[model samples]
Target: MPPHARSRIESDLPGDQAAGKPAPQQPAWPDPGLLDEVQRELLNRPALVPAEESAHLADLMAAVARREAVALQGGDCAELFEDAAPSPVHRKLEQLYDLSATLREQLGMPVVTMGRMAGQYAKPRSSDWEHTPGGEVLAVYRGDAVNAAEADAAARVPDARRLLAAHDCAAATLKVIRESWQGRADGNRVFAAHELLLLPYELPQVRADPEPYASSLHFGWIGDRTREPDGAHVALAASVRNPVGVKVGPSTTAADLVRLARILNPERRPGRLTFIARMGADRIDPLLPPLVEAVSATGIPVAWISDPMHGNTTKTGRGRKTRSVQAILDELTAFVRILRAHGAWPGGLHLEMTPEPVTECVARSADARTAALNQYRSPCDPRLNAEQAADVVDAFVALLRAA
Candidate 1:
């Protein structure tokens, strides 16, 4: 049997239901019974992913942590119910497939693709309400899984029905995703994933099978908002066998990281834990090294992937949410530098991207960004467009080679 994770994890973490930090911007569901219905429906549906698939993903992640392979995971920031239509789903999958082929050529190692789809229908917010320039207040624009994206109060109110709608959309999208991946001589079954938030959505899938299930999603990672050391998210991750990842933001302490490793993977397991650090370019230099050092000292192998998207995201003067590819590239460069300095493997990268042309970036002039807004169709968060993704693919390989 595996020995318990080096002690002090107990002292470092909060009580059973808590970990990481507090979950922020959760919507208040109007009716509790609707949750029960949604849970039942999800539980009754055939598992979107079988137990074996999640295990396969874990095995892949294990190889990644050992530096034998690299992970290439990305997708829409938040999938909308309508986006499940064949056109949108196929567009995204085609881009991902092309991405996989490119990475395989450049990285010269097996590329494990985890599309943030099949069920990435939910997202966490920073506020419960949005204040307009006229000093008017309205419910925040939570993802479609929580409420409609309309401007009226009635449309924004958290309706439990959206949960069921999201599930249906996710199921359909999964089917399209699988179908699209076919006929590709290059195996891309690895192109599966989800946002891994939304307790009501995930709990049914989890409770149904005590072990991890990724029928539709081969793997997933917890976002920064839900990484609280003693929170329900960690509890869910700990209870499963699927390879789990936690976003380590700027504030996460090295001590906290060690505690996380201990609590999640006490066995000194290699593939079971991944820390997707998203410290901004300015913060990566000082903040990332100590955490890598601390975790490395524990002797537990964990994949250290960089999610430069969240850390580099910003709002333009036009009130548009954007991220600079340069910022992303810069932070990733810093991440690799620190991991190597500390003698740890840099496992891979996680990005928010899409096939559509959207998002305001360095090349996207103010006029272009404003024009891109006309094409921006994401329900939540910004994603790199096809051109931007291509730029990232080439630039990332070049950067890693230089490193």
Candidate 2:
């Protein structure tokens, strides 16, 4: 948009302060200056993006809450540091833009396209340490932000300096996204996001047209692993003005959901709080209804988006992490239908998607194996490629309209 428009949106975001819940498990970085320098550098650098973009997202999220528009959040399952280069970034941007087009053309409404990249350099894994089959233990591959994605002992250990590297990589990736979308008149704005992990890197990582990034990620979220009511993630998110979301897994309770809504969006700001429900296909049918009803009763309206990726992850015969395209679709179908029954908008869909032809799960996947998956490269999780993503869009639109 215009400079004036950007300034107006930038004006709405809150200045940095204590947007955190309280202390969770804050790790002791080997060196504190590394953290300090990274934070300072982030402040000096161009806002990873303009604040107006985030404000626009908040508005878009509101429309979703009202069922007037649907959001399409997708990107790399795990953003490799090497992929921070312009080429892969450009391709990913194209995939996102194309995904947005498919939704707008068929869904017949505005679509919010938030990429799970830029600042999404951190991840929450099952273990803080991992070992090879031969029993050589490693500290575990946290993310490019903390350690290398490789399994070597040297690569697995957290390096304090990697925090700065993460900022540089995020800056580079954000540069690509901004340039790609620069001067475009399209109202469909794409926002950058990542799991709001409690690591030192995530704390200072943010972007603005011009502002400090204590919690500047355009669309920051708390993953299922860290959604505890008393956890630091919830506390930290509560304090930020940027559009914030929380992912609810199959085990999340209705009471917990209501309490979380109150904590995150006490003012009941439109699009201020988004609840991304990731109940698997079977669980979505039975588990989602009461949660929706409970939240509705509380009168704290949050954009209800479905994250069909996480809950649907499966292991192949060769121990590959994969997901079925059909499982994702089935859960999403149930998500919209159940929400409609509750007299609420499904709001949007969250996906781990890429432009590359990786086999997350597709037809004939019953026989799918790791060897069968072409270009299978994600080190963290499985994702839908362009073809599979297109398949999803087609099915999702038809299902939404039928609703």
What are the models' TM-scores?
0.88, 0.88
Error of 2 at 403 (Å): 0.7
Best by the lDDT measure: 2
Query: What RMSD value applies to candidate 2?
Result: 7.2
RMSDs, each prediction? Answer: 6.7, 7.2
Give the Å shift of residue 139 in candidate 1.
Answer: 1.1
Model 1 spans with C-alpha error above 4 angstroms:
1-25, 181-187, 207-216, 364-374
lDDT of 1 by residue, 205-283 (tens): 6523544443335677777777766766777677677788899998899888898898888877777888999999889
Model 1, residue 171: distance off in Å is 1.3
Model 2 TM: 0.88
Clash numbers, per candidate: 18, 10
Candidate 2 total steric clashes = 10
Candidate 2, residues 1-403: lDDT per residue as tens digits?
A: 1011010111111343334334333333445556566656655655565667677778878888777888888988778888999999999888888888888888778888899988777777775566686788666666777778777876665666776777778888888888887776555657788888744555454443344333346788898878888766776677556888999998899989999999988998888889999988768888999999999999887899989889887777767778877788889899888988989988877888888877656553465554356668888888888898888877778888898
